[model samples]
Target: MLDVEKSVLYVAFGSLAEITIDQFRELAMGLENSGVHFLWVMRIPFEDEFLNEFEERVKGRGVLVKNQWVDQVEILRHGSVSGLMSHCGWNSVLESICESVPLLGFPITADQYWNARMVEDYYGVGVKVLTDTGSVRGFFSSECIANKVKELMNVECVKGKEIRENVKKLKGRGAAARSAMEEGGSSWDALDMFIDQLIFGKKKK
Candidate 1:
Protein backbone atom coordinates (compact mmCIF):
# COMPACT_ATOMS: atom_id res chain seq x y z
CA MET A 1 0.00 0.00 0.00
CA LEU A 2 2.81 2.43 0.89
CA ASP A 3 5.47 2.42 -1.76
CA VAL A 4 7.99 5.27 -2.23
CA GLU A 5 10.19 3.31 -4.64
CA LYS A 6 8.63 4.89 -7.72
CA SER A 7 9.21 8.62 -7.26
CA VAL A 8 6.14 10.64 -6.27
CA LEU A 9 4.90 13.57 -8.33
CA TYR A 10 2.19 15.37 -6.35
CA VAL A 11 -0.04 17.39 -8.71
CA ALA A 12 -2.62 19.75 -7.15
CA PHE A 13 -4.94 19.93 -10.16
CA GLY A 14 -8.27 21.17 -8.78
CA SER A 15 -6.81 24.42 -7.43
CA LEU A 16 -6.36 25.62 -11.01
CA ALA A 17 -10.10 25.51 -11.75
CA GLU A 18 -10.29 29.18 -12.76
CA ILE A 19 -7.41 28.92 -15.25
CA THR A 20 -8.43 28.79 -18.92
CA ILE A 21 -8.67 25.51 -20.81
CA ASP A 22 -5.35 26.16 -22.48
CA GLN A 23 -3.82 26.83 -19.08
CA PHE A 24 -5.37 23.67 -17.71
CA ARG A 25 -4.10 21.66 -20.67
CA GLU A 26 -0.63 23.08 -20.20
CA LEU A 27 -0.72 22.22 -16.53
CA ALA A 28 -1.72 18.64 -17.26
CA MET A 29 0.78 18.53 -20.10
CA GLY A 30 3.44 19.90 -17.80
CA LEU A 31 2.73 17.23 -15.21
CA GLU A 32 2.60 14.57 -17.90
CA ASN A 33 5.83 16.04 -19.26
CA SER A 34 7.54 16.97 -15.96
CA GLY A 35 9.56 13.70 -15.96
CA VAL A 36 8.87 13.58 -12.22
CA HIS A 37 5.99 11.25 -11.36
CA PHE A 38 3.32 10.68 -8.67
CA LEU A 39 0.94 7.97 -7.51
CA TRP A 40 -2.70 8.63 -6.69
CA VAL A 41 -3.40 9.17 -2.99
CA MET A 42 -5.22 5.83 -2.91
CA ARG A 43 -1.84 4.11 -3.19
CA ILE A 44 -0.84 5.86 0.03
CA PRO A 45 -3.73 7.79 1.56
CA PHE A 46 -6.40 5.56 3.10
CA GLU A 47 -9.14 8.19 2.64
CA ASP A 48 -8.45 10.44 -0.35
CA GLU A 49 -10.93 12.79 -2.06
CA PHE A 50 -10.41 11.10 -5.42
CA LEU A 51 -12.66 8.23 -4.24
CA ASN A 52 -15.50 10.79 -4.63
CA GLU A 53 -15.02 12.52 -7.99
CA PHE A 54 -18.54 13.96 -8.34
CA GLU A 55 -18.24 16.43 -5.47
CA GLU A 56 -14.84 17.76 -6.55
CA ARG A 57 -15.76 19.10 -9.98
CA VAL A 58 -16.74 22.66 -10.94
CA LYS A 59 -18.95 22.58 -14.06
CA GLY A 60 -17.18 19.27 -14.66
CA ARG A 61 -13.86 20.60 -13.34
CA GLY A 62 -12.94 19.70 -9.76
CA VAL A 63 -13.50 22.58 -7.27
CA LEU A 64 -13.45 21.54 -3.56
CA VAL A 65 -10.26 20.42 -5.07
CA LYS A 66 -7.09 18.50 -5.55
CA ASN A 67 -5.34 18.39 -2.24
CA GLN A 68 -2.18 16.37 -2.90
CA TRP A 69 -0.54 15.91 0.46
CA VAL A 70 -0.64 14.02 3.71
CA ASP A 71 -2.68 14.48 6.90
CA GLN A 72 -0.40 12.13 8.80
CA VAL A 73 3.27 13.13 9.09
CA GLU A 74 4.75 9.62 8.95
CA ILE A 75 3.48 9.06 5.39
CA LEU A 76 6.00 11.59 4.10
CA ARG A 77 8.78 10.74 6.58
CA HIS A 78 8.70 7.13 5.46
CA GLY A 79 10.55 7.36 2.12
CA SER A 80 7.48 8.37 0.08
CA VAL A 81 6.79 11.41 -2.13
CA SER A 82 9.60 13.09 -4.05
CA GLY A 83 8.32 16.26 -5.76
CA LEU A 84 5.31 18.58 -6.05
CA MET A 85 3.30 20.66 -8.56
CA SER A 86 1.28 23.24 -6.66
CA HIS A 87 -0.72 26.51 -6.96
CA CYS A 88 1.26 28.19 -4.12
CA GLY A 89 -1.35 28.08 -1.35
CA TRP A 90 -0.08 28.91 2.17
CA ASN A 91 -0.40 25.43 3.64
CA SER A 92 0.75 23.86 0.39
CA VAL A 93 3.85 26.04 0.43
CA LEU A 94 4.52 25.23 4.08
CA GLU A 95 4.07 21.49 3.52
CA SER A 96 6.30 21.43 0.45
CA ILE A 97 8.94 23.54 2.20
CA CYS A 98 8.88 21.19 5.15
CA GLU A 99 8.81 18.10 2.93
CA SER A 100 12.03 19.09 1.11
CA VAL A 101 10.75 18.32 -2.35
CA PRO A 102 11.71 19.99 -5.62
CA LEU A 103 8.65 22.05 -6.61
CA LEU A 104 7.21 23.54 -9.78
CA GLY A 105 5.17 26.62 -8.83
CA PHE A 106 1.89 27.72 -10.43
CA PRO A 107 0.71 30.70 -8.40
CA ILE A 108 -2.99 31.50 -9.04
CA THR A 109 -3.72 34.44 -6.66
CA ALA A 110 -2.31 37.33 -4.62
CA ASP A 111 -0.93 35.53 -1.59
CA GLN A 112 0.28 32.85 -3.97
CA TYR A 113 2.40 35.46 -5.73
CA TRP A 114 4.09 36.16 -2.40
CA ASN A 115 4.51 32.43 -1.75
CA ALA A 116 5.99 31.91 -5.21
CA ARG A 117 8.32 34.84 -4.62
CA MET A 118 9.58 33.20 -1.46
CA VAL A 119 10.13 29.89 -3.30
CA GLU A 120 11.65 31.41 -6.44
CA ASP A 121 13.29 34.58 -5.13
CA TYR A 122 14.38 33.84 -1.58
CA TYR A 123 14.77 30.05 -1.57
CA GLY A 124 16.02 29.64 -5.16
CA VAL A 125 14.69 26.13 -4.68
CA GLY A 126 11.64 26.19 -6.96
CA VAL A 127 10.97 27.32 -10.53
CA LYS A 128 8.10 29.55 -11.63
CA VAL A 129 6.65 29.46 -15.16
CA LEU A 130 7.75 33.06 -15.61
CA THR A 131 5.33 35.04 -17.79
CA ASP A 132 4.87 38.72 -18.67
CA THR A 133 1.47 38.91 -20.27
CA GLY A 134 -0.82 41.87 -19.38
CA SER A 135 -3.94 40.04 -18.23
CA VAL A 136 -4.59 38.07 -15.05
CA ARG A 137 -5.20 34.69 -16.67
CA GLY A 138 -2.17 34.93 -18.92
CA PHE A 139 -2.14 32.87 -22.07
CA PHE A 140 0.39 30.05 -21.94
CA SER A 141 0.55 27.42 -24.63
CA SER A 142 1.05 23.72 -23.87
CA GLU A 143 4.44 23.96 -25.50
CA CYS A 144 5.41 26.64 -23.00
CA ILE A 145 4.45 24.38 -20.13
CA ALA A 146 6.33 21.42 -21.61
CA ASN A 147 9.44 23.50 -22.27
CA LYS A 148 9.48 25.05 -18.79
CA VAL A 149 9.07 21.67 -17.14
CA LYS A 150 11.85 20.33 -19.35
CA GLU A 151 14.07 23.23 -18.38
CA LEU A 152 13.24 22.74 -14.71
CA MET A 153 13.91 19.02 -14.98
CA ASN A 154 17.25 19.65 -16.72
CA VAL A 155 18.47 22.04 -14.00
CA GLU A 156 21.54 20.25 -12.64
CA CYS A 157 24.39 22.49 -11.53
CA VAL A 158 23.54 26.08 -10.66
CA LYS A 159 19.75 26.00 -10.71
CA GLY A 160 19.62 22.61 -9.03
CA LYS A 161 22.38 23.14 -6.47
CA GLU A 162 21.34 26.67 -5.60
CA ILE A 163 17.74 25.59 -5.16
CA ARG A 164 18.73 22.66 -2.97
CA GLU A 165 20.79 24.86 -0.65
CA ASN A 166 18.16 27.57 -0.45
CA VAL A 167 15.35 25.10 0.29
CA LYS A 168 17.21 24.13 3.45
CA LYS A 169 17.41 27.77 4.47
CA LEU A 170 13.70 28.16 3.83
CA LYS A 171 13.05 25.24 6.15
CA GLY A 172 14.97 27.12 8.84
CA ARG A 173 12.87 30.21 8.18
CA GLY A 174 9.66 28.19 8.33
CA ALA A 175 10.78 26.57 11.57
CA ALA A 176 11.64 29.92 13.13
CA ALA A 177 8.34 31.42 12.01
CA ARG A 178 6.42 28.53 13.52
CA SER A 179 8.57 28.66 16.65
CA ALA A 180 7.76 32.35 17.17
CA MET A 181 4.09 31.49 17.85
CA GLU A 182 5.15 29.15 20.65
CA GLU A 183 5.67 30.57 24.15
CA GLY A 184 8.96 32.43 24.93
CA GLY A 185 9.93 32.41 21.30
CA SER A 186 11.46 34.84 18.79
CA SER A 187 7.96 35.92 17.79
CA TRP A 188 7.37 37.30 21.28
CA ASP A 189 10.78 38.94 21.16
CA ALA A 190 9.78 40.91 18.09
CA LEU A 191 6.43 41.85 19.63
CA ASP A 192 8.16 42.97 22.82
CA MET A 193 10.64 44.96 20.79
CA PHE A 194 7.83 46.62 18.86
CA ILE A 195 6.03 47.52 22.12
CA ASP A 196 9.28 49.03 23.48
CA GLN A 197 9.62 51.14 20.35
CA LEU A 198 6.00 52.35 20.67
CA ILE A 199 6.52 53.17 24.34
CA PHE A 200 9.72 55.13 23.67
CA GLY A 201 8.29 56.91 20.65
CA LYS A 202 5.18 57.97 22.62
CA LYS A 203 7.27 59.09 25.61
CA LYS A 204 9.34 61.38 23.34
CA LYS A 205 6.07 63.09 22.36
Candidate 2:
Protein backbone atom coordinates (compact mmCIF):
# COMPACT_ATOMS: atom_id res chain seq x y z
CA MET A 1 0.00 0.00 0.00
CA LEU A 2 2.92 2.35 0.70
CA ASP A 3 4.32 1.90 -2.81
CA VAL A 4 4.13 5.40 -4.22
CA GLU A 5 7.11 7.66 -3.63
CA LYS A 6 6.58 10.42 -1.02
CA SER A 7 2.88 9.70 -0.95
CA VAL A 8 2.16 8.10 2.38
CA LEU A 9 1.49 9.82 5.71
CA TYR A 10 2.35 7.68 8.74
CA VAL A 11 0.15 8.13 11.80
CA ALA A 12 0.96 6.83 15.28
CA PHE A 13 0.08 8.28 18.67
CA GLY A 14 2.54 6.10 20.59
CA SER A 15 1.37 3.47 23.09
CA LEU A 16 0.53 5.61 26.10
CA ALA A 17 -1.99 8.09 24.79
CA GLU A 18 -5.48 7.80 26.30
CA ILE A 19 -7.60 8.86 23.37
CA THR A 20 -11.39 8.70 23.49
CA ILE A 21 -13.37 6.84 20.86
CA ASP A 22 -14.85 10.12 19.68
CA GLN A 23 -11.41 11.57 19.18
CA PHE A 24 -10.39 8.51 17.23
CA ARG A 25 -13.42 8.86 15.02
CA GLU A 26 -12.58 12.48 14.39
CA LEU A 27 -9.07 11.50 13.41
CA ALA A 28 -10.37 8.76 11.16
CA MET A 29 -12.75 11.04 9.34
CA GLY A 30 -10.12 13.71 9.03
CA LEU A 31 -7.66 11.35 7.37
CA GLU A 32 -10.35 10.06 5.06
CA ASN A 33 -11.23 13.62 4.11
CA SER A 34 -7.61 14.67 3.58
CA GLY A 35 -7.43 12.60 0.39
CA VAL A 36 -3.79 11.82 1.09
CA HIS A 37 -2.62 8.23 1.21
CA PHE A 38 -1.90 7.15 4.77
CA LEU A 39 -0.77 4.30 7.02
CA TRP A 40 -2.38 4.48 10.48
CA VAL A 41 -1.16 2.44 13.45
CA MET A 42 -4.24 2.16 15.64
CA ARG A 43 -3.99 1.00 19.26
CA ILE A 44 -7.62 -0.07 19.32
CA PRO A 45 -8.63 -3.49 18.07
CA PHE A 46 -9.62 -3.69 14.41
CA GLU A 47 -12.74 -5.59 15.36
CA ASP A 48 -14.24 -2.41 16.79
CA GLU A 49 -17.27 -1.39 14.76
CA PHE A 50 -16.09 2.14 14.04
CA LEU A 51 -12.74 0.95 12.74
CA ASN A 52 -14.32 -1.71 10.57
CA GLU A 53 -16.37 0.94 8.83
CA PHE A 54 -13.42 3.30 8.59
CA GLU A 55 -11.25 0.57 7.01
CA GLU A 56 -13.90 -0.22 4.45
CA ARG A 57 -14.31 3.45 3.60
CA VAL A 58 -10.62 4.13 3.19
CA LYS A 59 -9.63 0.75 1.77
CA GLY A 60 -7.84 2.00 -1.34
CA ARG A 61 -6.23 5.08 0.18
CA GLY A 62 -5.20 3.90 3.61
CA VAL A 63 -3.85 0.92 5.52
CA LEU A 64 -4.85 0.45 9.15
CA VAL A 65 -2.64 -1.62 11.48
CA LYS A 66 -4.67 -2.28 14.58
CA ASN A 67 -3.65 -3.58 18.00
CA GLN A 68 -0.39 -5.07 16.88
CA TRP A 69 3.30 -4.49 17.30
CA VAL A 70 4.68 -2.75 14.23
CA ASP A 71 8.21 -1.88 13.20
CA GLN A 72 7.72 1.89 13.26
CA VAL A 73 11.28 2.63 12.19
CA GLU A 74 10.87 0.52 9.09
CA ILE A 75 7.68 2.35 8.18
CA LEU A 76 9.31 5.73 8.64
CA ARG A 77 12.29 4.67 6.53
CA HIS A 78 10.09 3.57 3.66
CA GLY A 79 10.34 5.73 0.54
CA SER A 80 6.62 6.27 0.44
CA VAL A 81 6.28 7.86 3.89
CA SER A 82 6.42 11.64 3.52
CA GLY A 83 5.01 12.96 6.81
CA LEU A 84 4.47 11.67 10.35
CA MET A 85 1.52 12.39 12.67
CA SER A 86 3.07 11.73 16.02
CA HIS A 87 2.41 12.05 19.74
CA CYS A 88 5.88 13.66 20.06
CA GLY A 89 7.44 11.10 22.42
CA TRP A 90 11.21 11.54 22.61
CA ASN A 91 11.95 8.27 20.83
CA SER A 92 9.42 8.97 18.09
CA VAL A 93 10.80 12.48 17.68
CA LEU A 94 14.33 11.15 17.29
CA GLU A 95 13.25 8.41 14.91
CA SER A 96 11.49 10.97 12.72
CA ILE A 97 14.56 13.18 12.85
CA CYS A 98 16.90 10.35 11.87
CA GLU A 99 14.63 9.45 8.97
CA SER A 100 14.39 13.13 7.89
CA VAL A 101 10.62 12.95 7.80
CA PRO A 102 8.74 16.07 8.89
CA LEU A 103 6.19 15.77 11.71
CA LEU A 104 2.64 16.83 12.44
CA GLY A 105 2.75 17.04 16.21
CA PHE A 106 -0.20 15.90 18.32
CA PRO A 107 1.43 15.76 21.70
CA ILE A 108 -0.27 14.13 24.69
CA THR A 109 1.87 14.50 27.81
CA ALA A 110 5.18 14.75 29.68
CA ASP A 111 8.06 15.96 27.50
CA GLN A 112 6.00 15.57 24.37
CA TYR A 113 4.73 19.12 24.55
CA TRP A 114 8.27 20.41 24.71
CA ASN A 115 9.32 18.14 21.87
CA ALA A 116 6.47 19.41 19.74
CA ARG A 117 7.35 23.01 20.47
CA MET A 118 10.96 22.38 19.56
CA VAL A 119 10.00 20.67 16.34
CA GLU A 120 7.91 23.62 15.26
CA ASP A 121 9.48 26.66 16.87
CA TYR A 122 13.12 25.72 17.29
CA TYR A 123 13.85 23.38 14.38
CA GLY A 124 11.33 24.66 11.80
CA VAL A 125 10.97 21.03 10.65
CA GLY A 126 7.33 20.46 11.57
CA VAL A 127 3.91 21.88 12.51
CA LYS A 128 1.73 21.45 15.57
CA VAL A 129 -1.98 20.72 15.47
CA LEU A 130 -3.39 23.20 17.89
CA THR A 131 -6.55 22.73 19.85
CA ASP A 132 -9.33 25.30 19.95
CA THR A 133 -8.54 25.84 23.63
CA GLY A 134 -5.34 25.84 25.68
CA SER A 135 -5.88 22.62 27.60
CA VAL A 136 -3.33 19.82 27.51
CA ARG A 137 -5.89 17.27 26.36
CA GLY A 138 -8.09 19.54 24.31
CA PHE A 139 -10.17 18.16 21.49
CA PHE A 140 -9.98 19.21 17.86
CA SER A 141 -12.61 19.04 15.20
CA SER A 142 -12.23 16.81 12.17
CA GLU A 143 -11.98 19.85 9.91
CA CYS A 144 -9.05 21.23 11.81
CA ILE A 145 -7.35 17.88 11.71
CA ALA A 146 -7.85 17.56 7.97
CA ASN A 147 -6.52 21.05 7.36
CA LYS A 148 -3.36 20.43 9.33
CA VAL A 149 -2.69 17.19 7.48
CA LYS A 150 -3.20 18.93 4.15
CA GLU A 151 -0.89 21.77 5.18
CA LEU A 152 1.92 19.39 6.06
CA MET A 153 1.49 17.07 3.06
CA ASN A 154 0.99 19.68 0.39
CA VAL A 155 4.52 19.86 -1.04
CA GLU A 156 3.64 22.78 -3.26
CA CYS A 157 2.92 24.98 -0.26
CA VAL A 158 5.62 27.31 1.04
CA LYS A 159 5.48 25.89 4.56
CA GLY A 160 5.80 22.39 3.20
CA LYS A 161 8.88 23.32 1.15
CA GLU A 162 10.49 25.01 4.14
CA ILE A 163 9.86 21.96 6.34
CA ARG A 164 11.38 19.71 3.70
CA GLU A 165 14.52 21.81 3.52
CA ASN A 166 14.81 22.01 7.30
CA VAL A 167 14.42 18.24 7.68
CA LYS A 168 17.03 17.66 4.97
CA LYS A 169 19.57 19.76 6.88
CA LEU A 170 18.69 18.00 10.16
CA LYS A 171 19.22 14.63 8.52
CA GLY A 172 22.71 15.71 7.54
CA ARG A 173 23.46 16.72 11.14
CA GLY A 174 22.17 13.40 12.45
CA ALA A 175 24.47 11.57 10.02
CA ALA A 176 27.41 13.61 11.28
CA ALA A 177 26.53 12.86 14.92
CA ARG A 178 26.38 9.13 14.13
CA SER A 179 29.81 9.31 12.52
CA ALA A 180 31.19 11.26 15.49
CA MET A 181 30.20 8.46 17.88
CA GLU A 182 32.29 5.90 16.01
CA GLU A 183 35.62 4.56 17.38
CA GLY A 184 37.99 7.48 16.81
CA GLY A 185 35.71 10.51 16.56
CA SER A 186 34.87 13.48 18.80
CA SER A 187 31.91 11.82 20.57
CA TRP A 188 34.03 8.74 21.21
CA ASP A 189 36.75 10.89 22.73
CA ALA A 190 34.24 12.61 25.01
CA LEU A 191 32.85 9.26 26.16
CA ASP A 192 36.38 8.00 26.87
CA MET A 193 37.10 11.09 28.94
CA PHE A 194 33.96 10.58 31.05
CA ILE A 195 34.78 6.89 31.53
CA ASP A 196 38.34 7.76 32.52
CA GLN A 197 37.07 10.26 35.09
CA LEU A 198 34.74 7.64 36.58
CA ILE A 199 37.48 5.03 36.90
CA PHE A 200 40.49 7.18 37.87
CA GLY A 201 38.72 9.91 39.94
CA LYS A 202 40.52 12.59 37.92
CA LYS A 203 39.21 14.84 35.18
CA LYS A 204 41.14 14.98 31.90
CA LYS A 205 43.29 18.13 31.82
Candidate 3:
Protein backbone atom coordinates (compact mmCIF):
# COMPACT_ATOMS: atom_id res chain seq x y z
CA MET A 1 0.00 0.00 0.00
CA LEU A 2 1.86 3.09 1.29
CA ASP A 3 5.08 1.32 2.31
CA VAL A 4 5.38 3.00 5.70
CA GLU A 5 8.65 1.57 6.86
CA LYS A 6 11.01 4.24 8.16
CA SER A 7 13.10 5.87 5.39
CA VAL A 8 10.75 4.34 2.81
CA LEU A 9 9.23 6.82 0.34
CA TYR A 10 6.19 5.89 -1.74
CA VAL A 11 5.12 8.18 -4.57
CA ALA A 12 1.73 8.08 -6.32
CA PHE A 13 1.60 9.77 -9.72
CA GLY A 14 -1.29 8.21 -11.63
CA SER A 15 -3.40 8.23 -8.46
CA LEU A 16 -4.45 11.73 -9.42
CA ALA A 17 -5.55 12.58 -12.92
CA GLU A 18 -2.53 14.82 -13.56
CA ILE A 19 1.11 15.17 -12.50
CA THR A 20 4.35 16.56 -13.88
CA ILE A 21 7.38 14.47 -14.77
CA ASP A 22 9.37 17.50 -13.81
CA GLN A 23 7.98 17.38 -10.27
CA PHE A 24 8.37 13.63 -9.97
CA ARG A 25 12.03 13.64 -10.98
CA GLU A 26 12.78 16.40 -8.52
CA LEU A 27 11.34 14.37 -5.68
CA ALA A 28 13.04 11.17 -6.75
CA MET A 29 16.43 12.83 -6.75
CA GLY A 30 15.68 14.46 -3.43
CA LEU A 31 14.84 11.21 -1.70
CA GLU A 32 17.78 9.41 -3.28
CA ASN A 33 20.20 12.10 -2.16
CA SER A 34 18.80 12.08 1.37
CA GLY A 35 19.43 8.33 1.52
CA VAL A 36 15.76 7.45 1.59
CA HIS A 37 14.47 4.27 -0.02
CA PHE A 38 12.09 5.12 -2.85
CA LEU A 39 9.13 3.63 -4.71
CA TRP A 40 8.11 5.63 -7.76
CA VAL A 41 5.32 4.70 -10.18
CA MET A 42 6.19 6.57 -13.35
CA ARG A 43 4.08 6.36 -16.53
CA ILE A 44 6.31 4.53 -19.01
CA PRO A 45 7.33 7.53 -21.12
CA PHE A 46 7.33 5.77 -24.47
CA GLU A 47 5.83 2.73 -26.08
CA ASP A 48 6.68 -0.82 -24.97
CA GLU A 49 9.89 -0.63 -26.98
CA PHE A 50 11.01 2.56 -25.20
CA LEU A 51 10.15 1.25 -21.76
CA ASN A 52 13.57 -0.37 -21.64
CA GLU A 53 15.12 3.00 -20.90
CA PHE A 54 13.05 3.28 -17.74
CA GLU A 55 13.69 -0.33 -16.81
CA GLU A 56 17.42 0.16 -17.15
CA ARG A 57 17.29 3.20 -14.93
CA VAL A 58 15.26 1.42 -12.31
CA LYS A 59 17.60 -1.53 -12.49
CA GLY A 60 20.62 0.71 -12.07
CA ARG A 61 19.25 2.26 -8.91
CA GLY A 62 18.21 -1.01 -7.28
CA VAL A 63 14.66 0.35 -7.36
CA LEU A 64 11.35 -0.96 -8.60
CA VAL A 65 8.81 0.94 -10.67
CA LYS A 66 5.42 -0.53 -10.03
CA ASN A 67 2.08 0.28 -11.70
CA GLN A 68 -0.03 -1.82 -9.41
CA TRP A 69 -2.72 0.22 -7.72
CA VAL A 70 -1.77 0.70 -4.06
CA ASP A 71 -4.02 1.17 -1.06
CA GLN A 72 -2.83 4.64 -0.05
CA VAL A 73 -4.80 4.64 3.20
CA GLU A 74 -3.04 1.66 4.69
CA ILE A 75 0.37 2.97 3.69
CA LEU A 76 -0.07 6.53 4.94
CA ARG A 77 -1.33 5.32 8.31
CA HIS A 78 1.41 2.68 8.57
CA GLY A 79 3.98 5.01 10.24
CA SER A 80 6.92 4.17 7.98
CA VAL A 81 6.04 6.81 5.42
CA SER A 82 7.68 10.16 6.07
CA GLY A 83 5.90 12.16 3.35
CA LEU A 84 3.93 12.04 0.10
CA MET A 85 4.57 13.66 -3.29
CA SER A 86 1.04 14.43 -4.32
CA HIS A 87 -0.88 16.64 -6.78
CA CYS A 88 -3.02 17.83 -3.82
CA GLY A 89 -6.28 16.52 -5.25
CA TRP A 90 -9.19 16.75 -2.77
CA ASN A 91 -9.34 13.05 -1.98
CA SER A 92 -5.59 12.82 -1.47
CA VAL A 93 -5.65 15.96 0.62
CA LEU A 94 -8.37 14.59 2.89
CA GLU A 95 -6.49 11.34 3.37
CA SER A 96 -3.32 13.11 4.39
CA ILE A 97 -5.28 15.21 6.87
CA CYS A 98 -7.02 12.16 8.29
CA GLU A 99 -3.81 10.14 8.56
CA SER A 100 -1.66 13.07 9.59
CA VAL A 101 0.77 12.26 6.80
CA PRO A 102 3.06 14.98 5.49
CA LEU A 103 2.96 16.23 1.89
CA LEU A 104 5.03 17.86 -0.82
CA GLY A 105 2.63 19.67 -3.14
CA PHE A 106 3.44 18.95 -6.79
CA PRO A 107 0.05 20.11 -8.01
CA ILE A 108 -0.55 20.61 -11.77
CA THR A 109 -4.21 20.64 -12.73
CA ALA A 110 -7.52 22.45 -12.53
CA ASP A 111 -8.57 23.37 -8.97
CA GLN A 112 -5.28 21.85 -7.78
CA TYR A 113 -3.76 25.29 -7.59
CA TRP A 114 -6.54 26.31 -5.20
CA ASN A 115 -6.10 23.10 -3.19
CA ALA A 116 -2.37 23.71 -2.93
CA ARG A 117 -3.04 27.29 -1.92
CA MET A 118 -5.39 26.14 0.82
CA VAL A 119 -2.83 23.71 2.22
CA GLU A 120 0.27 25.91 2.14
CA ASP A 121 -1.48 29.19 2.86
CA TYR A 122 -3.95 28.29 5.60
CA TYR A 123 -3.33 24.71 6.72
CA GLY A 124 0.43 25.03 7.18
CA VAL A 125 0.58 21.42 6.10
CA GLY A 126 2.75 21.19 2.95
CA VAL A 127 5.32 22.86 0.72
CA LYS A 128 4.74 23.77 -2.95
CA VAL A 129 7.37 23.06 -5.61
CA LEU A 130 8.14 25.75 -8.17
CA THR A 131 9.51 24.86 -11.58
CA ASP A 132 12.17 26.93 -13.31
CA THR A 133 10.88 26.37 -16.83
CA GLY A 134 7.14 26.55 -15.92
CA SER A 135 6.30 24.58 -19.05
CA VAL A 136 3.77 21.78 -18.67
CA ARG A 137 6.41 19.55 -20.23
CA GLY A 138 10.13 20.26 -20.08
CA PHE A 139 13.47 18.58 -19.62
CA PHE A 140 14.14 18.44 -15.90
CA SER A 141 17.28 17.74 -13.93
CA SER A 142 17.12 15.02 -11.32
CA GLU A 143 19.56 16.96 -9.16
CA CYS A 144 17.02 19.75 -8.67
CA ILE A 145 14.36 17.19 -7.89
CA ALA A 146 16.45 15.70 -5.13
CA ASN A 147 17.16 19.03 -3.52
CA LYS A 148 13.47 20.06 -3.36
CA VAL A 149 12.50 16.68 -2.01
CA LYS A 150 15.09 16.96 0.73
CA GLU A 151 13.75 20.36 1.63
CA LEU A 152 10.13 19.15 1.75
CA MET A 153 11.06 16.18 3.97
CA ASN A 154 12.99 18.35 6.38
CA VAL A 155 10.22 20.93 6.55
CA GLU A 156 7.55 18.27 6.99
CA CYS A 157 9.20 17.16 10.24
CA VAL A 158 7.85 20.19 12.09
CA LYS A 159 4.80 21.06 9.98
CA GLY A 160 3.38 17.57 10.29
CA LYS A 161 3.37 17.96 14.04
CA GLU A 162 1.49 21.21 13.69
CA ILE A 163 -1.07 19.72 11.29
CA ARG A 164 -2.09 17.11 13.85
CA GLU A 165 -2.79 19.86 16.30
CA ASN A 166 -4.77 21.76 13.69
CA VAL A 167 -6.87 18.67 13.07
CA LYS A 168 -8.08 18.64 16.63
CA LYS A 169 -9.00 22.30 16.39
CA LEU A 170 -10.89 21.86 13.10
CA LYS A 171 -12.75 18.64 13.86
CA GLY A 172 -15.18 20.57 16.00
CA ARG A 173 -15.84 23.02 13.20
CA GLY A 174 -16.41 20.13 10.82
CA ALA A 175 -19.00 18.62 13.13
CA ALA A 176 -20.73 21.95 13.39
CA ALA A 177 -20.83 22.26 9.61
CA ARG A 178 -22.42 18.82 9.33
CA SER A 179 -24.90 19.62 12.02
CA ALA A 180 -25.99 22.74 10.17
CA MET A 181 -27.18 20.64 7.23
CA GLU A 182 -28.86 17.74 9.02
CA GLU A 183 -32.63 17.17 9.65
CA GLY A 184 -32.98 19.85 12.37
CA GLY A 185 -29.98 22.06 11.59
CA SER A 186 -29.76 25.67 10.42
CA SER A 187 -29.97 24.89 6.70
CA TRP A 188 -32.87 22.53 7.24
CA ASP A 189 -34.79 25.14 9.20
CA ALA A 190 -34.20 27.74 6.50
CA LEU A 191 -35.48 25.42 3.81
CA ASP A 192 -38.58 24.63 5.83
CA MET A 193 -39.41 28.30 6.30
CA PHE A 194 -38.97 29.13 2.62
CA ILE A 195 -41.34 26.32 1.56
CA ASP A 196 -44.01 27.44 4.03
CA GLN A 197 -43.83 31.08 2.88
CA LEU A 198 -44.07 30.10 -0.78
CA ILE A 199 -47.12 27.82 -0.28
CA PHE A 200 -49.03 30.36 1.88
CA GLY A 201 -48.28 33.27 -0.45
CA LYS A 202 -49.49 31.30 -3.49
CA LYS A 203 -52.79 30.48 -1.75
CA LYS A 204 -53.32 34.15 -0.78
CA LYS A 205 -52.75 35.35 -4.37
Candidate maximizing TM-score: 2
Tell me how candidate 1 scores on lDDT: 0.54
Q: Rank candidates, lDDT, best first.
A: 2, 3, 1
Candidate 3 RMSD to the correct structure: 7.7
81-150 in candidate 1: lDDT tens per residue?
Answer: 5545567776566666666666667677767767766777676777766664622235655556655555
lDDT, candidate 3, 1-205, per-residue tens:
3343544555665454543445444545555565555556555433453345444654433255555667777767676666666777776776666666666666667776677667767876665555567432233356655654665555345654565456556655655655665789886677777887788753221
In model 1, which runs have C-alpha deviations exceeding 4 angstroms? 1-6, 13-17, 39-78, 132-137, 151-157, 178-205
* TM-score of each model, paired residue for residue: 0.59, 0.83, 0.60
Can you rank all candidates by TM-score, best first? 2, 3, 1
lDDT of each: 0.54, 0.86, 0.59
Give the Å error, residue 201, model 2: 19
The 10 consecutive residues of candidate 2 with the worst lDDT sum are: 132-141
Please report the TM-score between candidate 2 and the true structure: 0.83
